[model samples]
Structures are given as C-alpha cells and as structure tokens.
Target: MAGGHIEGWSPESLEYLDACPVCGARTGQELLYHGLRDKFQVNTPGAWDFYRCGACGSGYYNPRPTPESVGRLYEAYYTHAHTAPLEYAQLSLLGKLRRILGNGYRNYRFGMHERPASILGILAVWLMPDQRALLDTGGRHLPKQPKGRLLDVGCGNGDFLLFAQRAGWEAIGVEPDPKAVEVARARGLTVHLGTLETLHEAPESFQGITMNHVIEHVHHPRATLEHCYRLLKRGGWLWIETPNLDAQGHARYGENWIGLDTPRHLVVFTDRSLLRLLEEVGFARIERLPYCPLCERVYGMSRALAIGASPHQSPPLPREERVLARQAEANARRRPEIREFIMVRAWKG
Candidate 1:
C-alpha cells in the first residue's frame, strides 16, 4: 500500500477528460471536490478530483481510472459477497414470509392484482396494502407478461434478473465483472461477461433495459444512453437510477458522503441533468419515481462507519451524530430534487 496506491492500478492507469461527458460542454466548468478517496476500497491511492458543468450541472471525475485499471478498483468488492444469489432452499420461516410479502408487494407496485396462488401472498397483500413499497423486491413498472427480452446493464450477480424472471420477464444481463458473472450463470441466467459495447446485435433488439446505480460509473453518459436507445424496441422502457449530487448528505458529510465514491462514481446527476441526458438521447414519456430508501441507509451507514461504529451499532444513534442523516432524509421528503438518488423511467422514441 505504499504511496497509497491499490495493487493493480498500475502507474499508467488514468484517463483525463477535456470536456463534459454528458453534454459535451467544454467551458463553464467549476471544480467541485478534490482529494476524494476511494473510501469503499480504502487501500486505493491518490485522491480523485471532480468538476461540475455549468451548462448541464452534472459533476464528474476529471482524471478517471482507465478501462484497463478500473477493474482493479473493484477487486474483492463487497456486493459480490453480500448480494449472493437468492438461496431458496435455505430460507428460514421468516425468510419464507419475506419472500411471500415480496412477491405480493411486487405485484402491487406494478398495478397488478392477480390472485395470489398462495395463501401467504393473499394475506400479506391484503393485510398491508400500505406497506407494498417497503416489501417490494423492486422491479417496479414492468409489464405483466413475458413478451420480449430485457437487458440489465451491470447486472451484478443477477439478483434483479431473478426477480424479473419470476415476474414473467425474459431476463438477460451484461456485466464486466467476471466473478459476478459466474455467480449469475450458476443460477441459470443468460448473463454475458462484458460491457454493453460488446453486444454486437441489430438495433431495437430488447424490449426493456435497466441500469440501476450504474450510469454514474460510465465513462460517457450520453454515449451509454444512446446505445441504450439503439438496443431497445420502439416505445420500450429504460430505467436509469443514480446518486443525486444535490442531496443534503453531500453538504453535510462533504467527501465522506458514501454516494461520492470518488473515482468509481464518475458522473453524479441531479434531476434536471438526468432528464436532459435522457431527452437528448431521444427518450420520451419520462417519469420520475419516488426516492429510494437505500439512499437514506447509505448516509446512515456511512455516518456509523465514519465514527468507527460497528455494523451492529445499536439503534438510536447519538443525537449529534444522527442529525445530518435525519436532516438529509427530511430534505428528501420536502424537496424531491434533493433526494439522495433519482430513478427515472423513460421510453425510447
């Protein structure tokens, strides 16, 4: 760990940008954050710098890790282990109950009311219609039938694919992480080990595409969305979710905000910035969904970690330590624009 550099990020591993990757705006750029570390990969060296575009108001890394060296940054990434493929046979009684609730909640979220085949699902959905949002497994806004193929970009370990499959959607995924792809394939999922650029196929081949928390990591946001538009069928849906730069957590935690994962999260977007990117790519019928609670959890967890608190840190955090997270979530409720992340659903024209 000498010089604070990660092992595989060779000295030759960084690409400097001359213009905004989103809007291609070269001038009117302002420095946003500097000396931001890869706190997720605490071993990574050399602080990262980010700049904001005055034209589009999007924030991005100035010197991002090159394609060759970026893989090293994700080595031993926690998501691979924590989000392990769903283990059905090993479910405890409570786990089984959660599954039932999750299934019912999924249906409720999508405006479907199919009679649940199981009694558990019936009771769960019937007894607690208001809790549908919390119980949902999160493939919201999907059609009821498996009409066509759906592509999930950066579909790490294919957890969402599994959920989509259960909901009757044909699921395919492309992931650059080989280890994660392995886990996905073991579950009988049709997952390829590479980025979307590796897909050599006709345009309009997919019925829908999703990139949850993935777009910000992309080197070129506009190019990625254009590719998405090309791959999707006419009128097909595209769901893109990413961290919001306007969140109060950024103001409170500064560099320690978990959303600003430094070099990894290259482009952070606000609602307006994200809308512009999608619309500029010819997407139509754009709609904004409710804020993701995971964003609040990120701030809470990051705060705990910052104070050296254990993962099992007892609830009811100290008043002083908890103020920032509470205020951020309150802001999220009051101002949707300030939500920690934005999930946009749009259709390809």
Candidate 2:
C-alpha cells in the first residue's frame, strides 16, 4: 500500500540516521518493528521502519524524513487549521463536571493544592489522574512564579500560549509551520517561526519549558533536550509528552499503534529510557504521570481503520477503548511503566 510523494520535497531528501540519537552509539541498534503508517491522519505514502538502541533501549526511525523534507510531511497536518478559542462556559454540565474533576486531580497530584474543596473534590482527586503534559495544553500547570517566562517548543496555532497568557505567564512559542505560525501570530502570540535547533535564545532565559507531543518529532531528541536544558534556568521545570514505546496499545496493536505515527514520530521512549535521557541532561526530581486519553482515543481509531472501518466515521465506533483503559490501569498498578504516552516533568539541576 504505497502512497504518493510528500507535497514540497522529493523522496530523495529523506535521510538515514545510523547512530543512536540518544547515546550516539553507531552500532548495536536492532530493528524493533517495520511497516508502520501515518495511521492517525493523512495516510501518507511510504512505510516507516523503527529501530531500538541496544545501549539505551530508545527507539527511532532509521531512514526518516530529513529536516528539509520534514516540512512536506506536515503539509496536510490538522494543526494548521484555524480554530476559535474554546468557550468553556457553554459546555454541558457533564463536561463541566469532568473539567472540575480533572482540575481537582491535577492540583492535588502536583501538590499545588493539598486540601480538596469538598468531598466531591476529594473523590475527583482520587478518580481522575494527572498528566503534566496534557495539563500544559490548557496552561494548568504553569509554575507558581507570576509572570514568569515560559516557552513552548513546537507550539502549534498558539492555543497553549493563549492559555498561558490568560494564566499570567509570559507565553512564547517556537513553531516551524508557516500556516500555524500565521494563525498564532493572528492571535497576538509571540512565536518564533523555526525549529528549536535554529532558535538561539539566551541561556537560562525561561522559568518553564514545555514540549508536548513534540520531542518525538525531532530528528535528534537528545540534541533537542540538550537545547532545552541550556535554555532553562537552574531549578526550572521541563515538561515533555511523547508516545510510550512500552504502551499496552503497542503490545496489542503492534505496527498499527496510533501513537507510532510512523514517519513523523522519529523517536519513541519507554519510561526507563526517557528517564535516563533526562538524567543525562541534568534533569532531576523527575516524575512520570499517567497515560493520556488522546492515546487511547487514537488507538481506538487506528483499530477501527485497521479492521476496515469507514474513514468518514467521527469516533470510529469504539474499538476496545474501555477494555484497553482497564488493561492499562491494571498494568500501571502492577508496573507503572507500560502505558500509552509518556508524560514527565523534571527540574534543571
């Protein structure tokens, strides 16, 4: 099932990376999987292959889309679509309840607010889980420092920046997509139009830095994290969210795991591997959070499509979401390492 070429770059622009991006080891890398697809969206042409480093157990795409050709990989990307800011007041009672539950759990989980508002809040805190990366989507996890400088790497459409601005942080972002940058700029956001590798900001300039679903897309994740390390002040926080290679969905779905994202998700990390990378970058006080709901939703969609489900379907007719959620919960209770999506927070020390 070969697909068409990318929009702006030729196939020849793709490059093969032989060395392990995390450890810089040239040998002892083993093939982990093959024939992954752009299953989440766009159904792009070409099968992608993934390999794991024997030294670090970190996984990455071998012949990946080069930095130059990468732009073409996202031409039909959904993030470029303009969307109005959400109006939460208009949400239904159930939605509002869920929001409250989510927020209560977040505050309690992060030790931001130890006392619950009520019995319901306590129950909410107990039921709902925490993922710092997802919370950053709404700027819910901004540092206690008022008006502190925060940077969002690969911030698309400035949605998070808007939330951060409202939360009293000086929000700025770096994005590579011209259309996404245009949309963010239209919203009056301060966004640099380039990759983090190209952005040369002053050292220790930011109090908090977030990379939500962005690290896996970079060609060299270690280099990107190194840049993040240099950009953060001592004791600053670095939040990262990416696909988990040890996720239960990957165990169940194999190559069709939605989080894989084939060619786009160049690197995938397990809990141990990601923790090691953070430690190597001088990040301390690290915390690993729960699986993101988006990963489960995406896994369901991928399962549906794999079984010949209609592409026009909105939610894709629920394919084992609840079952997988229960399975993930059970596994996390036992090992806490096998779950979809890696959500972690560490401090620059």
- Candidate of highest lDDT: 1
Q: Lowest summed lDDT over 10 consecutive residues: which window, candidate 1? A: 1-10
lDDT (Cα atoms) of all candidates against the true structure: 0.74, 0.73
Show pairs that collide, candidate 2. none
lDDT of 1 by residue, 1-349 (tens): 0123433455678777778888888899888876677666667776777888899888888777877778877777654653453565678878766765665556645444433324466467658643543444276557665457889999988888887876667889999988888888988999988899997757999999989899988887888889999999998989877888887777666777767776788899988899987888898789886555554566665675466553235244566756766676666766878777787789977
- Residue 9 local lDDT, model 1: 52
Off by over 4 Å in 1: 1-11, 82-97, 107-130, 135-137, 308-316, 320-327
Candidate 2 C-alpha lDDT tens digits along 1-349: 1123543336688777768877788888888876656665545777667888888778888777878878877887766876673456866887667666555654543334422223365465444454443554345356545447999999999888876775567879999999899999998899999999778789999989999899888888888898999999988889887878888777877777766776788888888888988898788779865444454465665576577563336354354566665656666556757767777888888
Instruction: Compute the lDDT for candidate 1.
Output: 0.74
Error of 2 at 118 (Å): 12
lDDT of 2 at 308: 52
